[model samples]
Target: MDLAAEVAALTDEFSGVVRVDRAGSTVLDAAFGLADRRHGVPMTVGSQVAMASGNKGMTALAAMSLVEDGTLSLGTTARSLLGDDLPLVADDVTVEHLLAHRSGIGDYLDEDVESDIDDYALRVPMQELATTEQFVTVLDGFPTKFPAGERFSYCNSGFMVLALLAERASGTGFHDLVDERVLRPAGMLDSGFLRSDDLPGTAAVGYVRMDGHWRTNVFHLPVRGNGDGGLYTTTADMHRFWVALFAGAIVSPETVALMTTPRSDVPAEGQRYGLGFWVHASRDVLGLSGYDAGVSFRSFHDPVERLTATVAGTTSAGAWPIARLLEERLVTTSPAA
Candidate 1:
């Protein structure tokens, strides 16, 4: 099937966007279904979609950039930077632990401890937990999950601490530092952290299909996104991100290699977690995935074919199927896919 036919089939049941960049060229760039179904606004290549935990990679990169300048060190302790703000965190927890998710700290909305995002947001008033400082007290009353580096357990709070440290080191806010150091350099102009109540024009309004109907997801997220998540971006911009990241435009080539190195060994067979991405050898492609509230995203860059494919959606359910179908097509057509 052609691009249009493939997209139509996916859109018939879902609202989403799929973007493909093959050998530095756009093989497919299309948006299907609606960004705001009530207003009949359709998603476009320029439409902004939430990246959720996808922003973790960007945050990690931002922290590493400061490390490159000697302003911060991977060995720097979170306690030193945060001072009295995060007295609950262990003094030995290093920046590396946070970046690698090995800090084993308590998460405000931990998947293992907490069952659902919707329930968690209800208690906190999603709009109130906007900045890293505002969220510091969430974990203050809770004890550390493990000492500091007992093992790797994904922790949202750890990333928040990293954001605070990054901001302090650069003497700038987390959002501004990322804009100047990472997004601007990568040319991701349409992407930034936004408040839950104030979505910019051309941005997709996330929806959660519940009780056999799609509902807009406003209360399901935080008021403002922080370092760990809550970033809005376009597939075209993400394609540029992968290029800039892998090509060492944002960091040194050695640092890029270090970021891609798998730090934690997953107990599940044949899987590992890198600093900011996931390492999978299913078909010799490196990739990452993020899902939260009403957003779902996945992207892969094939080293052998020099090709990449990314899928993003306003709703969480649409990303995986689109990603799988794109992979199937690419595998059948290319020598390396």
Candidate 2:
């Protein structure tokens, strides 16, 4: 698909990183724009960028690890562990329902309802939302959208509740559990939930375009990532993640099969969904995507081919267009397709 040629036209404005790895080797690695415009720090392939909702895949893995070790189970109801924190979630909502996005629970950040992307969308200051427990206040008040297991309506709060469930069941923090069960075993040394306010030099600054000016996403998103989103990783680490996940490093081979097994047909997304990853509607490609006020990311992996293509950037919209191009190319050329 002439990867370089496709990415060239947008080089002037694309702010982030893009890379492709095939069969244990790098096929493409390119960095564009800046990590921090204020400091004039150019983005590098090593620069860490937020994955937004893309982190859900990791959250799912963390929950599955608990299941694998008998600390939790798919049949475990949210009410059993969460108690009275989120009273809106029905007692029938289970861990499996949450993983498959069929929980039908009230979503804190409900996408079905129309709301602009801003800090005000959260009921409290974004900075206060640094941990999974801190999210209950903001997650409060939204009513259940449907009956449990009624349908596949994507719910961000479902993952948050899963994190809470895992924590209660495993006696571990959500972020720490993910690190131990997902990132650590996946060989993803560079990925973790980094606080947006105190980012390290290796991480990119999330920037939202506001009124013809560029601004940091510090105020528009949570201070530290929670269940639904907010984790940082380099393109290199992301590639490692895909490889390890399929190699049965993060979860069992049987569990991997379960996770990648398509559960619902999402026509709106033009794809099907497994546990936490997005499944290709017609092919063997698995994808992860994220978007927010100052973050955009998408990663596609062909398990059999051991090929990965990822587009991650600091702006809310930069990576998707390029990701669409990559997906089209992959869908056509994937061996399993």
Candidate 3:
């Protein structure tokens, strides 16, 4: 089967960028449709797209660095570092709980409970949320959903607090610290916490399909993303990041091992929650996926084949099919055991 062709066929259905790689070789690197339909811009391999909640992995990596340095432990109480700033967090919630999405704090943007992301954006202007401290109000209003370590609930607010903890413990701005320590070290030169209004060149403007046309998503997201999301990056850069992460270039092997370790059970069938990555086991691969407004992504590492596959999309719902196609092809093309 021609996997690339199959993925290409779906591009007009879901306008965005798609890239795939294996063992340092470009297996499929293609872009289709418009990145900026208004301006008629096409997404290139270098075009940066907002990964939305996909940025969680970088936040988790920042937290793990503190863990490696003995500044904080995974089991350290969340309240201890964040103090009165997050009075609503349960007493039992720990750093690990946030990392693993097991902290039962209320998600600020609960799509299941709330119908519209734009409605929540109205309560607080997206432009005001530029720093970790700015997000405190969002978490403070939501009560604990359950006791810490009870279950995996996919809490974005939990990660927001984690970013605050990193700032408090490291005595550095969360965005700056992550950039200096994590992005730079991982060789992710194009990734950063760009303000929603001032996105860099080569960055794809996120769009929502409305009335058979695409509208820019600047007003639909927080002005700046915290630990939960808001980093812009390219597919090639993300591939470099995954390679560095697995090879332990950005953190120790011991640290990466800990991040990859399943910490809590996901209610989603056949899935487990790690520090920041999602682990899905089917037959030949375990993977991570993230989706949010105007962004979709999936990446997998096949231990049996010693291969990796990644898909990054500017639209909200195109990554899985592309990643799946690549995965099926790679597994079939793998050398005999």
Candidate 4:
């Protein structure tokens, strides 16, 4: 299959960037559609776009770095760290459970099995969620779904607790901890948790299509990112992240192995859950994905082939089709796939 042709055909329907790297070399890099439709800004290769839940990968990395430094352990429990702050969360819900999405804790912004992504309501006002601590108030009301380590269920609130744990352990803010432990060490200088309302010109504005008209996603998400999501990065910075992560620059090799190791199966998606990534065991692929109102992102790295592919879109559903096509092409043609 001609990868370029496949992506070219998607240009009309998708509005974002597609990038692929092989053996630490750039193999493909292309941009499509508008970054800021109102301002007539075209999406560029250098534009930084939001990665909603994709930020979970960095949260996991930050938490694991503390584990590497003997500051925390996978076995550390939320009850032990939080100590009655979140009274309903079970005592057995550990850091490992949260990292692997096995924490049966109730989610504040629960993505119900049948709900539309765009219509999923935020429990709190979007403008109020500025920090991880603020998220704790939102997370407080939901009852625990099941026993800790019972099964795999994606829970955003669990990660918020993990971020709190990291902060307590490191004596640093969650954002600063991630920057110091994950981004800077990975050489991702351009990536950080910037506020949605205050993004600079280099960052793409998120969009959503409503009532046959394009609309900004400014009102659909938190004002600023927390541990669960809302991170912005460039394709080039993500490429550098993959390189540094695999090279054991951010965390130790043993920690990486633990993170990428598949601990549970996600039968619905036909994938497996690792510490913070999705693992395709058959293809030796590791990925981190995110989707929210006016935000879509998928990034993958194949360890054996040293290949990386990323699709980041500024619209809610724009990145999926392109990402799926790329996955099909790579799986059928790439030697590692």
What is candidate 2's lDDT per residue for 138-248, written digit by digit as tens? 777888989988899989999998888888899899889999999999888999999998999999998877788898999888899978999999898899898888788
Per-prediction TM-score to the true structure, in the order listed: 0.92, 0.97, 0.91, 0.97
lDDT for each residue of candidate 1 in 83-156, tens digit (9 for 90 to 100):
78767788899999999888877776675664554333535666668777777766565568887778888877
Which lDDT tens digits does candidate 4 get at residues 221-253? 889887889999989989999889989999998
Error of model 3, residue 25, in angstroms: 1.7
What candidate 1 gets wrong by more than 4 Å, as runs, is: 1-7, 120-122, 210-212, 267-270, 282-284, 328-337
Candidate 2 residue spans exceeding 4 A from truth: none
TM-score for candidate 2:
0.97
Model 2, C-alpha of 337: deviation from truth (Å): 3.6
lDDT of 2 at 208: 79
lDDT of each: 0.79, 0.89, 0.76, 0.88
- Per-residue lDDT for 179 in model 4? 98
Comparing 3 with 4 on TM-score, the higher-scoring candidate is 4
